[model samples]
Target: MTARPTKGGALYALPNALWLTFFFLAPLLIIVAYSFMKKGLYGGVENEFSLRAYALLANAGIVKVAFRTLLVALAATALTILIALPVGYNMARSKNQTLKLFLVIVPFWTNFLIRIYAWIAILGNEGTINGFLRSVGLISDPIHLMYNQGAVILVLVYMYLPYAVLPLFSTMDKFDFILLDAARDLGAGKLESIVKVMLPNVRSGLVTAVLFTFIPIFGAYAVPLLVGGKDGYMLGNVIADQVMKVRDWPFASSISMVVTFVSTIGVLLFLARQKRPGVSKEQAAALAAEAAVAAGGGR
Candidate 1:
C-alpha cells in the first residue's frame, strides 16, 4: 500500500509560521499602513490618506541618493560574490574545513560598531596607511581615504563578504567534485568546467548570498554614515533623515515601502528560478527535504 503523507509537517512548521507573522508580516503591514497615511505636522503621522510621501520620491535629491545607493549596492554585491566564490571553493576543498569556517565567522564575535570604528582608525587621514607611507617618505602628505564613496564601498565589502561566503560555502560543501572531473574528461577547460558545471549547481547559494549581501547593503545606514560622509548618503540615510531630521513619517514609510517591495520582488524572482526544467517532482521534493534538514541543523 502507498503510504499516505501525514499532517505532522505543518505542526513542526507552526513556530516559524507564527514567528514570521509576528516579526516580519506585522511590521511590514505597519510600514505599509504608515506609507499610505498622511504625515503629521510634528513627529507622528495623521489618519488621513495621502500620496505626498510617494510623490516626494520624485524629488531630485532623493532620486540621486537612490541611484547612488543602487550603484554602491551593485558594486559591493558583485565584488562580494567574486571574492566569496573562490573563498568558498577553497574552504570547501580545505582539509581543515571547520577551522577555516571558524576563521570566517570570528569577525561576528565583535560588535559591528566597534569594527566600523576600527576601519575609521585604519583609514583616517593620519591613520595607519598614511603613517606607514610617511615613515617611508612615499608622500609628504596623507592621502584622503576615509569619508568617501570608496571607503564606504571598501567597508561594505569587508562587512558583507562573510555573509556571501557562508551561504556559498554551505552549498559548495554538498556539491560533487566528480562532476568537475567529468567535465574535464569531456575536454572542458578549468574555467569552463567551473562556469558550466559548478556555478549552475551552486546557484542556490549564489541566490542566497546575493540576497543577503545586496538587500542589506541597499538599506545600509551606519557604514555610509560613518565611512561615506557627505557623498555616502544612500536611500537608508534618506529614510533616516526624513524621519528624524525632517519629522516626515509618511515619507520615510513610503521609501521603506519601496525597499520592502523591491526586496520582496527580488526574492520571489530568485525563488522561482530555483526550480529548473527537466527536474522531476520527486527530485525537487528530495532537494527540499535535504534543505530542510540542513536548515534545521544550521539553526
Candidate 2:
C-alpha cells in the first residue's frame, strides 16, 4: 500500500507551494495575458486583444536582434564549457579541497555589478589597460577596447564561468579517475580516453552547465547595455528598450513569451537526453575487455 503524506509534510510544503503560485505562476500568467493584449497609447497594456505584438516579431530588425542574441549566447556557452572543463577537472581531482573551494567562493564575495563594472574599467578606451599602454608609449591613442561584441562575449564568459564549473565539478567529483587509467592501459591515448570514458560519465553535468549558462546569458541585459554598444546589442536590450523607452509593453511581453518558450524547449530537450537509458555496467565491461584484446593483438 502507498503511504500517505503526514500532516507535518503538508504543512512544510504549504509555504513553498504558496510562494510558487503567487510569485512564479501569477507573474507568468500575467505576462501570457499581456502578450495577447494591445499596447496602450502612453504605456502598459490595454484591454483589447491582438496578435500585432507577435506579428512584430516578423520584422527584419527584430529577427536580426533575436538571431544575434542566440548566436552570442551559444558562443558564450561553448567558450565557458571549454574553459570550465579543465578547471572543474582540476578542482575535482585536487587533494587540497580547501584551495579549490576558496577559488570558487572568492568570486561570489564581490557584487556581480561590481565585477561587470571592473570589466568596464579594464576594457574602456580610457580604462586601465589603455591608460597603462599609453603611459608606456605603446600607442599614441587609446585602443577601442570597450563597447564591442568581443568585449561583451569576454565579460559574459567570465560572468558565467562559475556556473559552468560548479555543475561540472559536482559531476566530476563522483567520477572514477581509475577509468582513465584503465582506458590508457587498453591503449587509448589521453584525448581518446577522455572522449571515450570521462565525457560519457559526466554528460549530465555538462548539459546542466550548458543550460544554466546559456539561459542566463540569453536573457542578459546589463552586460550588453554597458559593454555592448549598438553593434553588440541583444534581444534583452531590445526588450528593455521596448519596456522602458518605447513603453511598448505588449511587444515586450510578446518577446519575453518567445524567449520563455524557446528556453523551455531547450530545457525539455536536455531533460529528455538526460533521461535516456545509458549502457549497463556489463556492457561497459565488455567494451573495456574488447579494447584490452585489441591492444594485446597490436602488441
lDDT of all predictions, in order shown?
Answer: 0.83, 0.82
Candidate 2, superposed: residue stretches over 4 Å from native: 1-3, 274-299
Worst 10 residues of 2 by lDDT: 290-299
Decoy 1 TM-score against native: 0.85
TM-score of each: 0.85, 0.88
Worst 10 residues of 1 by lDDT: 290-299
Error of 1 at 108 (Å): 2.6
- Count of clashes, each model: 0, 0
Candidate 1 regions exceeding 4 Å error are 1-24, 275-299
Question: Candidate 2, residues 1-299: lDDT per residue as tens digits?
Answer: 55686778888789999999999999989989988999988898889989989999999999998999999999999999999999989999999867886777576557778888999998888889999999999998888988888999999998878777776776787899999999999999999998899999988777767877788889888899989988888998998899999999889999999888888987786757655566343443343333223212210
lDDT of 1: 0.83
Q: Estimate the TM-score for candidate 2.
A: 0.88
Q: Residue 131 error for model 2, in Å?
A: 1.0
Best-matching candidate per lDDT? 1
